[model samples]
Target chain A: MGSMARAKVVALSMVDKHPEPQPLLAVKLSPAENPTAEAGADAAAPINSSALPAPEPEVVPTVSLTKVFRNLLAQITRERITTAALACVSIGALFLFWYIGTKYRVEFYIRFKNVPTPYEVFQQLTQVGLSNKYLVNIAISVRRILLGFFIAMAIGVPLGLAIGKYQRVRDLFMPVVEILRPIPAIAWVPMSIMLWPNNEASIVFITFIGAFFPILLNTIHGVHSLDGVLIRAAKCLGASEFRLFLNVILPGSLPHIFTGLAVGMGVAWVSLIAAEMISGQFGVGYFTWEAYSLVDYPAIVLGMITIGFLGLACSGIIRMVGSLLMPWLAFAPGGKR
Target chain B: MIMATAMAETQKGLIDVRDMGVTFGANDNKIIAVDNVSLNVQPGEFVSLIGPSGCGKSTLLSIVAGFVKPTSGDAKLDGNAITKPGSDRGVVFQQYSLFPWLSVRKNVEFGLKMAGLEQSKRNTTARALLDLAELLSFENHYPDQLSGGMKQRIGIVRALATSPQVLLMDEPFGALDTQTRVVMQEILTNIWQQFKISVLFITHDIEESIFLSDRIYVMTARPGRIKAEIKVPLPRPRRAEMTDTPEFMNLVQELKGLIREESLAAMAPEIKDRGLSGFGMKVGPKGVGDIF
Candidate 1:
């Protein structure tokens, strides 16, 4: 009994003497003082550690499920309300213009074959999409864009890589490239017709001219921008010259290459429309010119809509591919947004 | 002790460099980076080069790695002249030169692939090295995710993957915090003993040089030349506790004296005019000259 008492006294004295972490030591002594009396206070110490302010708490009330749902709903409602208002304003303005044309400016529509009204243009948009004439023009324009874009890619990518990797090659080619780059794609029409016997080849050459420069320039820029440190690190790792170029240089330049492709596709679409207008017999631009000559107002409107839709579709495809090819470049300027 | 000396004699010179000099630029602006200097490294020995900034310790290691060619003299490894970088010599740079794009496994497998090892063998070798570095679980992690010390360990493992005869380190732990650096030093010492590879380490830390090296070479500043080479008699498989001993302090003082003399010599002008005693740098306040 005496030894037990002495042991308890010694324990209490040690706890009192060493007070470096005073609150913590006191909490421990409290629990020893009463078996179950200070259990609640002992548990409070662990709670104090956790109660310290976290920079970003995990389950913040502001970011809870209910609040997030409410915010999402609010945003969707706001967007819908704005879109509806825009639609109303646009329709009202369009109607007022149509009324004015009907009342005063009749020559605009009357000059066309059979004198169609503004409503006729909308009707033609819905009806002409299913017609064989419209389908053929759309197919022809698409074929021209694809042939030109792919050919430019096939020639430009390898040439750009060579120019980027070798200073001598860049020196030899840069002058010729610069001299030709300033000449517009439409200017190539006259020379292409003389060089290639067929209209298809002429149109393809024009499209290629439009697409090539942007792709090639972007590719060269991409390769030039690769981090020199990455190359040196590869060399230190015993990577052979061939492996270094293939594995490091190529992948490092991919994000830039994708940028070029996106820009090239946009250029190719614009070139296709211009090339078709000049030399095409069966495309959206050619059909629009034919409608103008025959004074078919609704047909002209249909052709314009077709060209706009085609450009939108092709550009969308480019963006989709860019997203797939270089996911890390989503944050890049002029990306998806 | 006698038996150890006899063993060392058998492997008298693992690295023999003679009259090596590295000069940069041409004509009037030419600067001699490393003057005519020669040293030998024995097998399984740890040697360190210590000096102030711009002492050319890194340049000497680069020459040994065959990354740079000396303007004069030769650097031979096991009696063969070095012409290019090979798997025989592995260098750990001051920066954690881990390839960020690759996972830890792929980074470690880089040297094996360069050696033309088969896929199965490469996999096995990479796994073994990762395990040895205590980074087996981080095999799939990229370099950015790992801490600085972990990245350094990966750098060491990458070097070791080639099974090099000589290991070259240019201040491998110079970038770490003090506590972490000590831990890494202990880990490196353990690895060195296990592999028994001759290490040529460069550093500016005097205590580190004394603690880790079997012999420490102190170099003079600017146009660098070896000023002193002191052999550490402290017993090895060195532990952290040995740092507090009297022998360690005595060696630190000796190294300090040698470095102080070399620094004074480096700052002394080429032309001496005893008559103009109170001229140049020493005039005015304690640090008024701004000379480094």
Candidate 2:
């Protein structure tokens, strides 16, 4: 019975993907003819019913294509289908607008004459994606970003903790931080180049500068926002100063620390791309700038798309890690006290 | 038997406060939280501080817990000054101050771990305390997953994990619903009876004070001073039914009257500013409903 259900599922999935009118009939009728087949298929059906196509039909029957499509639609949740449909529509609308604007060469206040159409960019993406050079550039940019972000976390989090926990340390370091915080990362490029040994060091330093302040400021805020009663509770429970920090202060500040990390990652990408465009030998940012210089407009758009996806992937990774580290947050909304 | 004798010789859980006062800020900004408050708790006694809001009941408790330094006098435990918080005294806050990142068992074991207890011993102590609270099944759950009553119960169990001499609780059951609060009071009394540890509890609930404390100290409004000290003559191993007796009702009435007077006094300045000097008299005959 299990193997029979499995074979039926394979046939149904093939009908879904290929949409053969004959196979659709077979799927729609097999469930009706043998009542137990429907129950078995429902139980054995995989979450993603769009896998590889099966050649042979398990149970042939006679039914219309529309009826089979309706049956398949009924099996999934209505809300999920609606949400997915809405997302696709919105994305499609954006592409349609971009395609028309670029194809017609709209010359509004911001000219679209030089911009590539969706097709042109897709064509460029397929061509560029095949090359080892493009992958190397992406890898280099990712490596630089990870190195700078990790360094910022290592130094900024501890310094922020110290500055937040101790009044004397705050007083000593706050003046310097306040003075340097407002200066943009781009402005530091010249000074960073002079300070560091090479162009790579300078670019990394600029990325580090971008990521550091947000992490530091948020950490300080996290520490400041800790409940005083919690500290007192820990102290009364025999926690020494160091133990109190480990048990109460550090764990208490983690949610805010993650907030800082996410914000810092976004800023790190912006800073890295800016630094790369200005001084990098090889990276996605440099590729975009180089394409612009060589008048390869489609590749420039492809570079931007790559950066957007990479940034999204990095932020998503951070979010996933944060939620994993703080499982208590998942249960927070259920009970407040 | 030898260990029992040694424990008796250590002078377990005696809290002494002598004319202690705490003042916050300096000069014109200064606010006196507690003033000239003198109180003491005998070993194994259950004492409560009851007062109007803004009164120094919690401030006084904080002094004994060594979280605040008194501006005038001193607070002591076992004849030595309590200059700082120590393992000998455990505190439970109204906020249910369990670390959200930790599981229930880990929170209960926190103090033991801090005192450098071995992992196996910590687990044993935590499991025992959790079992005592009837929360052994929820040992793996985080604090945020629990209800108000459960959290406070965990808070109490966690505080008692280290076997502290004195337990300081600041309105631990105040956030719970009335039904849960009653159940919590019974649980606390049971725990107190079994441990025979001294307790210094702070609350604004008159009935709760009457029900829980062997002795109750009532304080006046802000710049708080001890207005009255009353003792409960109820027998030990107290049951929930004891709250219905004539004696409990009488004590509740007396404490209510005392607190009502202080509450009115606390509202005096606001009443005067509103040009309602005789408001209390006007509301007195109407049974409080008419004014609202």
Candidate 3:
């Protein structure tokens, strides 16, 4: 029959051994019949009849969309639902404000003439006609972001672990990291161009700079918070310092480091866009800048949306990875993983 | 494999501590957590350190484990100065000390894996240990999923897995429920008989000390020092029903009396320092979660 009916069938079979009265099921299963009180009470008598185990309902464990959807909905906790609703409301408000503010002149008391209407943007999106150009741009941008993010991780993770665990290493590098952290990624473009032989390398360098500090600092914080007792436990169990860091310190600090990576990925996107806007070709950021130069407001908005989507996806993937690595955390209360 | 190897290494009086003392923190904040806590454990002996909270019993155990260095005098393991934590000494803390990331089997296999054992051998050894301890079914389970008693029992198995020269337990059973604690004690006594490793078990429970220990070292409260060294004269293959025996009850009473006096002695200095709280056994409105 229908998916909902199938789901009910499955639910009923699971508790069929102690099946509750199925008045609702009866009404759904046989709509032609007008049920009387005598019939309903007579139907309830069979529930106890099944307790003696003459024959049970056919066990159908068939997978259905309704079952999957219901289970997923059930797993979406109150806190998660609240959070999702808040985010939807916030983004929806932004969209509504954008659409209404640019509806026409004198909209919302005052409005910028340069801002495009929501439908105008959506209309331009369908008529772009150059899907390959968009794909090529997005692909190159993603590649650059990935390259820079990985490079940042390669340097940042080991450095962070070392600096976190050893006071001497921290003292040696903390001043340098602190000094470098505050300087914006855009400011590095000029230096990067001078330091590198190619525009792509310089752009990637800027992105790397943007992603590096967040990853390093968060990893360090994670390592710093490593429970001293776990270390002792590891030590007493015959682990050398190197082995201790690998077995305990690295894994112990993973949750914090994953947080860093998520934040770093977002920063990587931001810095890559900035870098591309300044001096590069073939990226969503460059496309936005080109649209600006050509006064394509819709295209610029499209670029913004693409970048936001990519950043969100990257962070979402990081969170998924974190949950996979730390399965225990997923089942814990208030565990976002 | 477990019994024969353990018996071969059962040399009496393996751990020696002479006037072992430990003070914590820097100049102004420094507190003598342990003072002249002298005790020793014969090889295969189940020695228990019993005292009230804040009595530095854990500190004494740490000194032997080589996690904490003694401030004065010395503690030796098999005649060597216990300077640094090594594979030879396995330690089990109270609850929540198991590595949450590792599976129960992996936690037990941790030391063996660290010692560079082959993966197959480590698994075999770990599984064998789990089987003996009645925890084989829980090999894949996480520590967070297990009950307090199960966790501590597995914690004991993890410590014992490496077959250390000595097993230093710091209030390992203090977190279990009363019933689970008794079951765990029986399991531990049985395992100790089989493993035949020297144990320096720390506990705040008086009857637990009397039941599980060959010798119970009762320490005074904070700035803890050994106040009494009572030898348990009870016979081996101890049963839970033995607690009802007159001898067991008498030993329990004797330890309780000794611990109470030490608690008073521990409270005496604090009473004078506070000045207004001059007390004859006044219970404080506080909880101790730190080293005791």
Candidate 4:
């Protein structure tokens, strides 16, 4: 009896996980009246009937389960299949355009004569994808991006929080931020090289510069955009200043902070590649620039594709981490911002 | 009963406001939000402030919650002058101010956790409060997953979880549907009865104020000042049926009359300046009435 009750409890709890529509399990198990008794009987009967291989009642829940599965499959396919197909079509069209342009050696304002054909780029991809040197270059560039991005986040978030929360901090820092924010990452290449001790440090510095302002600005906007009522609610609930910041301000600003991080990841990749191209011996950016100097146009195209893929992956990881960090955002209408 | 008695050891939750006024901006931009609004709530009483839109009822509630400092006059909670927001007062806002990041249970436990309660105790307290709100089953649900009514109920439960001496509510049910608002009123009254905490509720709803409050204070238009204070003679454990009674209806009418006057007064300047007075004038040839 205890085991039957336990199974019943488990079944009921599982019902909660079902999406908005009522689970078929409930209807299959019992009539509208005396739900508990009928549900309990059905719950215990399922186990007993399974052991005895009884076909009559067992068929009901099995059919219901299949229906539920079919419903879920339909829902997933309905929303995702169209989107996926459109994305495929879009990418295919882009590739087709590229193939035509390079194959015909089309020249308008920009010349496609020197550009690698799609097949040549694919050949380069196969060669590069197999090479140890290509892997090393990718690894070097990724390390630079991660290091620079993390450092930017470490400084930008706290500073942005302080600036957003306090007038004095905002006044003290905003002028400096505004003045420095306009300087482009490529323009910082010369200054960064002179400022840092080594080529690696210089490249990372340029990446950090590329990533920092967006993060700082977004974090500030997040703090400013926080609903004032939540802060008041926190204070009223006995939160001290530090507790308020940790519990309210920090979490409140997180969505924007994640937005910053995602944007920063992309910018970091851009700056890292640019800096590497300008002053590095062993990175994807350097690989691309070297390919250009060597007139290996296909390798250059391959490098560009690799950089694009890595940047997308980095930003994708950031977004996944953000969604994980803020599980409630999933429940937000129209999906996560 | 013993727990209630122990919790009531101190003479807490007494809210006293004296000639409170709040003015914003400076020079040409100066706008007075509230003016000479004085009222008091006994330790366990449910009092409401009802006024026209922009009548500064929310501002008055904010002053008591210690979110806004009044330009003049004194506000105190249990004899301690209100300086800044503290744990002694719990506040519920109209906008369903549940932290979007936290689940229902976590939102309730926030205050207990802030007071440095251990995990087990906080969970127990939060669960107990969620049970009171009939939301224990939804403890794991986020705010957005809930309806507007459920979210506001969770907001109330979260405020109550702290076991504050006083609850300050600013139009907490304003956003709910009429049916949901009535249901919420019943729930709120039940919660208030169980907790026996002082309440200063701000609303523009006449029936709501009369239904839930022991006393209702009506305020005038902008630069809100206390227009009148009326005591509700309705019996305790207020039910929806009471809203149909003569006494309740009379009180509602009186409050309505008082507020309607203020509302018109509030709208007078806007109507004149914005040329909205034409709304009351005879219809032109293009009027919807002519088409009909």
Task: Show the colliding residue pairs in model 3.
Answer: B13-B42, B56-B292
Window of ten residues with lowest summed lDDT in model 4 chain A: A26-35
* Candidate 1 wrongly placed segments (more than 4 Å): A1-124, A132-139, A281-337, B1-13, B174-179, B253-292
Q: Candidate 2 lDDT, tens digit per residue, B195-231?
A: 9999999999988988899999999998899999999
- Report the lDDT tens digits of candidate 1 across residue range B46-152: 99999877878899988887788999999998888988777788788888777655678888888888778998998899999889899999998877777889989
lDDT of 4 by residue, B120-223 (tens): 99999999989999989999999989999999999998888878999999999999899999999999999999999999999989999999999999999998
- In model 2, which regions exceed 4 Å deviation? A1-79, A334-337, B1-11, B269-277, B280-292
lDDT of 1: 0.78
Worst 10 residues of 1 chain B by lDDT: B268-277
Q: What is every candidate's C-alpha DockQ against the true complex, given to 2 decimals?
A: 0.13, 0.63, 0.48, 0.66
Question: TM per model?
Answer: 0.69, 0.83, 0.80, 0.83
- Model 3, range A152-209, lDDT digits (tens) per residue? 9999999999999999999999999899999999899889989999998998899899
TM-score of chain A of each: 0.66, 0.76, 0.76, 0.78
Question: Candidate 3 residues B55-122, lDDT tens each?
Answer: 89877888887878888999988778889998788888885678888999999999999889999999
User: Cα lDDT of all candidates, in order?
Assistant: 0.78, 0.87, 0.81, 0.86
* Model 4: CA > 4 A from native: A1-78, A104-110, B1-11, B27-29, B269-292
For candidate 1, write residues A68-129 as lDDT tens digits.
Answer: 56657777877689999999999889767665665465565353335456677778877877
* Shift in Å, residue B42, candidate 2: 0.7
Q: Which of candidates 2 and 3 is the stronger one according to TM-score?
A: 2
